[model samples]
Target: MEMNLVIVGLVFVVLGYLVGVKKFTWLLAGYNEKRVKDKNKLALLVGGTFALLGIGIAISGFAGIQQAETIMFVAIGIILLELVYVNVKMVE
Candidate 1:
């Protein structure tokens, strides 16, 4: 579990680079294909949020905290919702 969380963290960091720095719009899963009005802002907010969530989950897992898995899954679910919002709402 700890290793898995760490792996997810690393993936999020990579996603931050791809979505935030590289401006990769298609990386997100939503069907909304609208162009973003402010790519940099969206990138910074989503990328940073994901990065922090990933790190927090990893740390919790490493500590063997009870219910950490549940928390992590819930957080990931929330992130997915955010991704949809970014697609459908944040874009032009």
Candidate 2:
């Protein structure tokens, strides 16, 4: 169980990175003429959140708590969806 949680946690983190990088690249390329304050903030917020999430999952794996790991999954999912929304807004 612990090993599985660790692995699943890592996957969530990678997925988060994938989504974030995609959005960041698009933001940078599409808004080259703009100030890019929001883009920079988004990068920092999303990147830091994922880093913390990955570390939390790793720690939870050591502690062996299923609930904590599940919460992490939910958090990751929510973050993913939020990123998608942000990307859509950027297009408008």
Candidate 3:
């Protein structure tokens, strides 16, 4: 089992919970309060992504998947797409 990935995944889950449920928008880097059109939407989108990604990572780690690099790449791609979507649609 990949302990490191599990640990990282747990951290992401915690962060996602804080941001999505606790409304800790400040945890997001490069986030601007004034520029964002809908704070709740931003929180939901980003936090949901993080939570899902974390779950996937944790599961993959526990399953001892040999293609962890592929998972990481997919995660990165998802994040990049999310960044673009947020910047283009959510930001003012």
The pairs that clash in candidate 1 are none
Candidate closest to the true structure, highest TM-score: 3
- In the range 1-92, model 1's lDDT, one tens digit per residue, is 56766676677777767776676746766524456777667877777776677777767767766685687778879788887777676777
Q: What's the residue-level lDDT of 4 in candidate 1?
A: 69
Model 1 worst lDDT run, 10 consecutive residues = 25-34
> On a 0 to 100 scale, what is the lDDT of residue 1 in model 2?
49
Tell me the spans in candidate 1 whose CA falls farther than 4 Å from its real position: 21-26, 30-34, 66-68, 84-89
How high is each candidate's TM-score?
Answer: 0.67, 0.51, 0.94
Least accurate 10 contiguous residues by lDDT in model 3:
3-12
Model 2 residue-pair collision total: 0
Give the per-residue lDDT of model 2 (tens digit) for 1-92: 48766876686566447536655434322344253347655665565566567767766876887686466667769667856765665433
CA lDDT of each prediction against the hidden true structure: 0.71, 0.61, 0.89
Clashing pairs in 2: none
Q: Residue 56 CA error for candidate 3 (Å)?
A: 0.4
Residue-level lDDT tens digits of model 3 in 1-92: 98877887788789889888888999999988999999999999998989999998898889888787788899889989999999999999
